[model samples]
Target: VMFFLFSLAFVQGVGSYLIQAGEDGSVTDDERDALLLWFGSVSTCMLTCFRVVTGGDDWGAYYDMLQPTGTINIIIFIFFVMFSEIALLNIVTGVFVENAMKLSQPELATLAFEQRKRDLADAASLRELFHQIDLDQSGKITAREWADIVETNEKLRYRLTVMGLDIK
Candidate 1:
């Protein structure tokens, strides 16, 4: 009973959050419809999970895997919900952290990306910026700097090219 109610309440929260996302970021008119469908499906699926496990206690004389009463079923459902929620929350957390980092310190992401590229470029003695350019040791960045910070090894070059990176 408590689990069912909790699932209902949690799903309600998700529904509200989805509405807020639509109104906040306001992706586009087209995305609005898809968001609705996705939220609806997720809410329905959660409800199904709650129903499937909540009433399984009386399920006797069945498959070897299923429990005689439904305690096991409920436990299994709870575990599933726990791990699924953890993974889902991690994804949400990642998105939030990315957005927050971008908003709070926009320059950091750019610098980090450039620094990574510079490191990779430097790894093979192909540093994009000359030592003089990095006078402060703060890895100088330039539009054309991206060009030199790349590898031309056939395998890597082909992989990136296949991903539409215009490696050539």
Candidate 2:
């Protein structure tokens, strides 16, 4: 919207310049009228800029009419085209990223829940294994118990090693 307004302003500025130049005898009345036909009023100028920006036709005529305004008009046209394209691309990218984040929210929650379930199951298994090793029912396994179990129980040793314990 801001780009549209700025482009409208550029169109109006060129129109004003051409009209004034015509009044001062630098530009002919016909040339001024031709330019003003598309940019004389705010509504026409806005519509014209919108059409040009959105790839509407008859731009060649407008470009030719703008020639009287020297290179400034050409520069303005180029700037408008580039800025509008960049702004539109940014808008599209932002929308895509926002949607992607929104869509992934449920998946992220599911992943966290699954991880928590696995942790709880692992904790239950470890508690059971600890009880089995605590032969005295002391609620804790002593180092001697751990060493004797690990030496005799290959399965327990492998489980400890897989769990990242320095059982050796």
Q: In candidate 1, what are the lDDT values of residues 1-168, reduced to their tens digit?
A: 544554554445445555666568744554444334322454553555444344533222222222221354446545655665676679899999999987886587788999899667645443432443343565765645434444323554554465455755
Candidate 2 clashing pairs? Answer: none
Can you give the TM-score per candidate against the true fold?
0.25, 0.64
Best by TM-score: 2
lDDT of 2 by residue, 39-120 (tens): 7776777777778767785567677877778787777776776787788789999999999999877777799999899888
TM-score of 1: 0.25
**How well does candidate 2 match the true structure, expressed as C-alpha RMSD?**
4.6
Superposed Cα deviation of residue 166, candidate 2 (Å): 9.1
The worst-scoring run of ten residues by lDDT in candidate 2 lies at 1-10
Q: Rate the local accuracy (lDDT) of all candidates.
A: 0.49, 0.78
What global local distance difference test value does model 1 have? 0.49
